[model samples]
Target chain A: MLKHTPFHDFHVQQGAKLVDFAGWEMPLLYRSILDEHEQTRKSGSIFDVSHMGRLHFSGKDAVTFLNKVLTRNISEQKAGQSRYSLVCNESGGVMDDVIISRDVKNWILVCNASNREKLVKHFTKVRHDLDLDFDMSDQTEGTAMVALQGPKVIERVAGVLPVDIKALKRYQFESGSYMGMLKFTIFRSGYTGEDGVEVIIPAKIAGMAIKLIAGKTDKPDATIKPAGLGARDTLRLEAGMPLYGHELTQTIDPLSAGLGWAVDLNKDFIGVEPLRKIQADGPKRRLVGLELEGQRIARQGTPVLLNGQPIGEVTSGTMSPTLQKSIAMAYVDAAHATEGTTLAADLKGTQVPAKVVKLPFYKRAQ
Target chain B: MLRKKAMPDAPKDYRYLESHEWHKREADGTITLGITQIAADELTDITYVALPKVGDTVTANQRWGDIESVKATSDLYTGVSGTIAAVNNELTKNPGLVNSDPYNAGWMIKIKPSNAGEFDKLLSMDDYRKKTGH
Candidate 1:
């Protein structure tokens, strides 16, 4: 059975085309994917991301337990702060990429929706074996998440909310009440590489708050529109954010995927040994971004060629709505992964010429 | 696959296949083939279209071409067995025409019917509509 979010009716009312995504019925687009993607880059847009998983870890050993399992250091995070971390298996392969938010008494971990059940099962096994005092609770069912993203999201959101969103630094969050509902967390963080906010609110009161927040018009700059998963993919692809199944998987190690910054070697984590070895002797394949010469878009599973020989495969590709060019992310031989290196992607019968550009094809001008 | 949905505006005289392919018989006894509007919408911006060469024999329900969109790759199937008479050469330069006029200028191929009997086996426009939940 497909699960529906509380915002399902709202999306339909907004003329969204709903699709089955990661076991949940979610909107693929409210209007044209091109319009939504362009609006997000030129102005701002809102997304219903309630399908993502949310886990709350509390008790005295919350920090200790997370630090032991996650690749990033959770113990060093200050209150009201969020950090990107990777959950890895014994071989240093990334299970899923998550954001760990540390509050006063509990640690909130936000992960990919598809990995939620599997992550919970993995956590249960670990909790039993480690004999820790940490309590893991699945709070995804009751949470309604929305992302306000773009260059003008800050001003758009500040117009409605009573709090000054500018005061909240990146990766920082604060609790606020909207429409008499005390349950809310406004995080100055988003998947798109832009100035944006992700709001988590109680499921029952989400519709009212979403209407109030998105209904207002920024007259001088019409920046906010409802975006869907289609826009989400293009926006994140331009921003160079790695999707779990695409750039990362249980079989790929974190260090090879250009996520070494998130790993702290000083701390001993669940997948430390393999990571240490991989760090010492660099990984065979490196994830890099490709900028195709023409409008021909490469696709996932398309072979990456170096001098007419297959090296690696493309994980994700799309026509960047903002750049108006074809861009893709692929894993290639480390030697040819450097920026400016020449490569070709076998797109059906033709091999499209491409260059290894920097990860993000578009970055928010701050 | 393009789910069969009822498009009341769609020409009821034509028939459709489950693979989202649509076929309409002209008064001249030739079959004009193209993707439905709903199928074209699902594909968004049609970038490149790979069509079968003219004069090639195609079987009923067999794939005749591939449609490449910014979002995904989808197979274009033959709704009826026929010999390829002509291909939409304009789509190679202006693929967006598929989304703009899928029923007319966006017609992918013209097939010379090999088995005119296959027409009876296809779904009517109403059946196609009900199957797609349109």
Candidate 2:
């Protein structure tokens, strides 16, 4: 049986095409994929992201334990601030990417839902060895997450929330009452490379909050069409962000994925030695972005060719709605990963010509 | 951001195929062919349509061209074997027409059929609907 979120009924009412995603019935799109993609790029768009895992940790020793387990230095994470981080196995292989936020009273480690159970087990192992006096609890079931993203996000969400959201900078959060009743937490962060805030509230009031923000009029009817998982994939791909299962996995390290900046070498964390040794030996292959000539998209696992020989494979790709061109992210041989390098992607037995460009194929206007 | 309108039933004037292409016998012994409305809705937001050249010979139940959307790409198969007489040049710049007016302006090609009796073997509108389970 597939699980349903608090807003499942809301999605049905909006004429969304529902599909089973990660064992959960989720909306794939409301009207059309192109419409939703264009709307988010031009104005604003809302998304239901309640599938993520939210873990709470507190106590004097919480900070010390998290710093030892995560890739980023947690001691530098100030109150009300969030930092992008990662967790790795002993081999320096990426387990999962996370966001560690220090709330007003506790610390929250947000992870991908598909990796929740594995991460929970990874966290449980830390308790047996360390003398840390903290407790780890999963708050994912009790809470719901919604992301409002775009250039007009702050201007549109301002009318719904009670506080001035403009005062909050990136990677900051604050707890407040939603419409003067339900307690909520709003984070000025999102996966899409757009100005937005992620709102977390109790599961019961999640539908009401979505109605308030997405409803066309003052009534509770949800007239505003919501974006689905398809648009979410394209949005993140256009932003050049990494997906856990795609660009990151048990055999892929963060350094080879071009995410080494997030790892703090000064701190002694799990997998530090393997990371240092890999750095000394250099990565065999590196991830790079490629721009195809036309609308023919190269899908995941498509072999990337350099001079008629396979070099690597594409991890994620899409016809970028913002760029109006075919673009992809792939791990190519270190010698062929440089910018301006010409390459070919074997798309359905046809070697379509491509070019190794910069990481991001599209960036929003300032 | 063109919104998809509620698709109507397949026009009875043309014969449908299980692969979703529709073709009709023209008065001059040639035939006009395009995709069905159900196929259009399945491939939403058509961005590019790659049709064969004017003189190309298309075999029955075989892949000849391609259509692409924002998220995926699909091969286009024709149910009738014919020599292409005319191609829809307008679809080069406007492929979404294949989704909006799939039966008319979105028509892909006009072909000179190798066997005119092939249209009788194609699926009727009622049979097509049942095959698609629409």
Candidate 3:
């Protein structure tokens, strides 16, 4: 069964293209993909991200429990702060990358919607074997999440939010009221490479929250717009953030996916032994960003070639709306994954020239 | 040519394919083919178009080439079998014409119809809009 978010009716009313994503009916685009991407880069845009999984762990040993199951050291995280961490299966493969937030009363986990059930099962199995005292509660159905991202993010959100969003540092969150009616938990973090905030509120008030951020009426406003999965994918690609299935997979290790900073081998956790061995030996294939030289767009599954020999396949690619150039991510032999390395992408029948450039084709102005 | 949100309408005298290809029997009895305005609207910001070369034989309902928009890549299916007479080479340098002028500057190819009767099977404007569920 395809589940619908709280903002499904609103997206349909705005003429969004809805698609089945991980059994959830999600909006792919509210307007043109390029227009939405540029809007989010220049000004600010809102996204309905309620489909992500939300879990709460409460008790004295909540931090200790998370530290054992997750790759990052969660015990060091201060209250009101969020840290990006990964959950790995026993085989040392990434099960999911999540945001671990430490609150005064409990620890919260925000994981990918597709991997939510699997993570829950993994957590249950881990708790069964370990001495842990914490209550794991699935709060996804009752929660609604929205992201406000871009250069003018704070300025745009300040109109509807009573809190001073500018005071919130990166990865820090605050509880406040939205338009002084509903309580909202907003954090200064986003998938897009921009200064932004993500708001988590009750599902019952999701429609009202969207209206407050997107404006009540259907008037074309440049300051704030409703972006969709299409823009979200492109923005994250430009930001060099690895998507779960694309960059980091069951067989792909985090060290090779350019996420070594997120994994701490010094800490004892699930899948740490295999990760340590892989880290010591070094990964054979590494992820890198590619910039196609010509106008031809390299799509997913397009083969990457070096000197006419097939080396790897493209994971995600698009004509970057910000740069007006084609960009892609691929896992190539570690030797070929270097800046300024010449490469080619076999697009359809034609071989388009490409170059391995630095990750993150776009960055926000500080 | 400058781009607008809505592309120009197909030549009213031309026949349209359910898949959005425009088929026009030119004054010289040769047929010209290109995508329709609705197709251009759906595939906005076309970055590349791999057009069929001259003398390449195209079969009805078969893909002759491909067009890549920023959003997706779609196959260009020929509605009528024909021997290609010419292609818009300028489109290689400027593919945005696919959205700016889908019927004029975006015209893909000219061909001598292999089966002239195939044109009658093509869809009308109303039929195309119905097929696309517009």
Clashes of each: 5, 0, 0
- Number of residue pairs clashing in candidate 1, backbone atoms closer than 3 angstroms, sequence gap of 3 or more or interchain: 5
Q: Write the per-residue lDDT of candidate 3 for residues B1-134, one digit (tens) a residue.
A: 11232424556678887888998888887888889878876776688888877998999999898888877899898888989999999898888787778888889999889998998888877777678775
Q: Candidate 1: where are CA atoms >4 Å away?
A: A179-182, A216-222, A293-295, A348-350, B1-8, B25-31, B51-61, B80-90, B110-123, B130-134
Q: Hey, what RMSD does candidate 3 come out at?
A: 3.2
Q: Model 1, A106-129: lDDT tens per residue? A: 889999999999899888888889
Residue A238 of model 1, lDDT score: 90
> Fraction of native Cα contacts kept in each candidate?
0.18, 0.50, 0.32
DockQ of each: 0.24, 0.40, 0.34
Q: Deviation in angstroms for A43 in model 1?
A: 2.1
lDDT of 3 by residue, A1-366 (tens): 899989899888877767888889998777667778888888878888999999999986777789888889876788889999888878788999999998778888999999999989989888878868789999898989999888887886876688887888899988877556698888999998988999899999999888876563355655778888888998999999989889888887788888889898999988899999989998888899999987778888899999899998899998887888899999999889989999899976678888999988887777
Ranking of all candidate structures by their TM-score, best first: 2, 3, 1
TM-score of chain A of each: 0.97, 0.95, 0.96
Two-way DockQ contest, 2 vs 3, winner: 2
The per-residue C-alpha lDDT of model 3 at residue A200 equals 90
Model 1 DockQ (Cα-based)? 0.24
Candidates' lDDT values, in order?
Answer: 0.86, 0.84, 0.85
